[model samples]
Target: MSAIARSTEPRLDSVTCASPAGLHRMAYWEWGDPDNDRVLLCVHGLTRTGRDFDLLAQALQGDYRVVCPDVVGRGRSDWLIDPAGYVVPQYVADMVALIARLAPARLDWVGTSMGGLIGLGLAGAALVSPALRPSRGRWGLDATPDVPLGRMVFNDIGPALDLDGLSRIGSYVGQDIRFASFQQAVDYVHAVSQGFGPHDDAGWAALTEHVFHEQDGQWVKHYDLRIAQPFALQTPDATTAAEALLWRAWDHLPMPALVLRGAQSDILSAETAQQMVSRNANARCVEFLGVGHAPTLRSEDQIEAVRRFLLTA
Candidate 1:
């Protein structure tokens, strides 16, 4: 229901993979049974880490093995030597490596913001002609027969994004910010993340806890600042091209999908959510009132929606 009790902590782990530049390690946090065949992979938004799903993972750990990975440049993952490699293609490659390691019979995905784009790529590629699918050997894994997505949840993201919203996000994503104290860091998180809707003191604290680390005696956000470079270089034409590709991906998805949109969201507009469902008969959308860019699945209501959707047969 509400946030998970603080007593239950996730198991932290990492996996080695390669990028265009060289090899790097991607860290992940796991909850639930390691041997469980059902796997749920939760990926965080830009500038956020995998630990963001702590509460959601806690709620579903009993029935499924919930794994959340910090996308390459964020959290415990090693930053790439070439910042230019910080694109969705690289993120997707790393995730494929992760899936190979887990080797689940069935896989489901929950992706937020940039993470959602990766899910779209995986699900779309799995459904399309084999030639379009990302090469398994590219990531150093043998071609395991297509691991069908059991279900997918795209949190406040869709094929089409609002450029204004993206610009606003870009303003803060990779800033060189430092905090004098933990409380100060929490305050900064709250300020930038007000769109996540309201949270009690403890809930807010829990959300902020894993996002910062002590560096040179100062508290700094955990992600590599270079992660923002590619984002900063986006051109209007590039965005248009990407949107066309995403729409193609959305139309080709074969598995059931749930789209959660914040009622006040600027990132994932209501118009795009409507288009998503219209294009794919298996897709459905739910809007959370009073929330903005995204819904942090920390509340009882938010958690229940995801739990029911994920557990459905």
Candidate 2:
């Protein structure tokens, strides 16, 4: 892979993450002086890559060491051999390995949408996976607490899902096509993310980067089309069954929590985010205006809020 400096200042690292299934090489962008003991691992969302954090990481570099991992199916990380393996349990396994390799001890976490769910699944003191403890397949680990996942930031997703909104996402989950130009990609992004609402030109441009890949002299999305397969399993019956288990895990989380919801999010309702706060004494929440489903932490206010949440209260 041709290595280019991830940022204008030219500081990045090509890191490798080894998991039992395979030696999955992950390209991570690291910032900060490298001597800082405080580490924050940032995880990106489904159909998105870790590069999503470039702006936020750049801003937080001086205060905390940041490591961003492109989840298995999305970016530099190797696609899983089995599409069935793309579920949360498998993701949790890869994360445990990553924490062991990068943060052997406690550390901070920042996640966006799907990444946030992964972090909450791991660090939530009471969070449990039915698959993990079932007699059948369980994260491929028969035991629990594989690693210490510290404080977490859950972006929008939660235990209960809005079926209508979820199905809305499924409408274009795996359409096979390509855009003619970068601006076309940007327009498509805005169209799909109507829920996110009112981003400036730069914010819109940054979001476009999340799904970028170059092919045949054109820029397209990087993820495999099959990622939509999981959404099929999100059948009404299955989501109802799965959501309860997630809530149970939340009920038992042993660490501090921060839940941020887009004010207009259809997925994680305002009611549920508040319930999460009520459950944990240390848990707090903030909603970004004119946003739905997620708050991309690109705005100065968004960045400052996260910094304050992590470093202070």
Candidate 3:
């Protein structure tokens, strides 16, 4: 099959990862040549599955081996026994294991929302000495060479987040709601995902497909409800400290970085995007008008923006 055709036919696979509680399996979808060492890892937003990057992956599969992972507690991945394990540090550890399994000579990342934070955690570690890197004692991975993170794309995310946007996200997460039918599920997803910008009926349906699954004759969200526990327990002080660390991480990145933000994004403000470019010489910013919070790569212009950068970078 052609590369574009093969992109639609992703090879489903899983990687074994560990956490403070125990070992769990994380699911991932692979596209393009399996033997290719130039790897592109595309991660989705919180509560969204790896399938969110289906379009973007399909477009770039020919140029790179695209791997999209469903972070722990979401999609086909195993849920953590301890909800606190749902944090970014744990997710970073899990990605470390996945990276070891792939052992890419060069790696590129495209992360949306929560995925961006995970990328920061891993990318930031590259600046640390190999001996000080995450070891088996931390999450069952040996201290290997620093990650080969190359060009990166942060999809509508940054170190400093707007409180109002954070509040909007927290308000809907972890709700125990079920839909009567597939149509009902689609309607609900569109209602809450307006920040993803405009899309046609099919577009919305594709976005909804992996987010909700049928269980006990009802369509419920695919993610574990407990994933929201950390957000609930996080204190304002903790959030502030975390932001400081994230900014440090942002400053440490030495690779070419692209920040794709919605012009009216509540999550990544205009000021923050500007600051990101100003703080890092290797970073640049691009905004999509009429969009808010995020510009889903499903759209042609958005996908092209990422494609052009990765190709030239």
lDDT of each: 0.85, 0.70, 0.87
Candidate 2 regions exceeding 4 Å error are 1-23, 124-149
Q: Work out the TM-score per prediction.
A: 0.93, 0.84, 0.94
lDDT of 2 at 32: 62
Q: Per TM-score, what order, best first? A: 3, 1, 2
Candidate 3, residues 1-313, lDDT tens digits: the string is 4654365778899999999899999999999888777889998898899999988989999888899999999999999988989998899888988887886777889999999989988887666746324333232235654444679999999999898998898999989999989999999989988888999999889989999999999999999999888987888899899999999999988889999999878999999999999999999998999888778898899999999999993
- Clash counts per candidate, in order, are 0, 5, 1
lDDT per residue (tens digit) for residues 1-313 in model 1: 2222232788889999898789999999998888777889999999888998988998888877899999998889999999999898788878878987786777888998888999997766655445333232221233434545678999999999899999999999888999989889989888998889988888778888888998888999898999889999999999999889899989978788999999999999989999999999999988899899789887888889889998888
In model 1, how many backbone clashes occur? 0
Q: Top model by TM-score, which number?
A: 3
After the best TM-score superposition of candidate 3, give how far the Cα of residue 167 lies from its true spot, in angstroms.
Answer: 0.8
Global local distance difference test of model 3: 0.87
Where is model 3 more than 4 Å wrong at Cα?
1-5, 131-147
Candidate 3 backbone collisions, by pair: 265-293
When summed lDDT is taken over every stretch of 10 residues in candidate 1, the lowest stretch is 132-141
RMSD of each: 3.5, 5.6, 3.0
Residue 249, model 2: Cα distance from true site in angstroms: 2.0
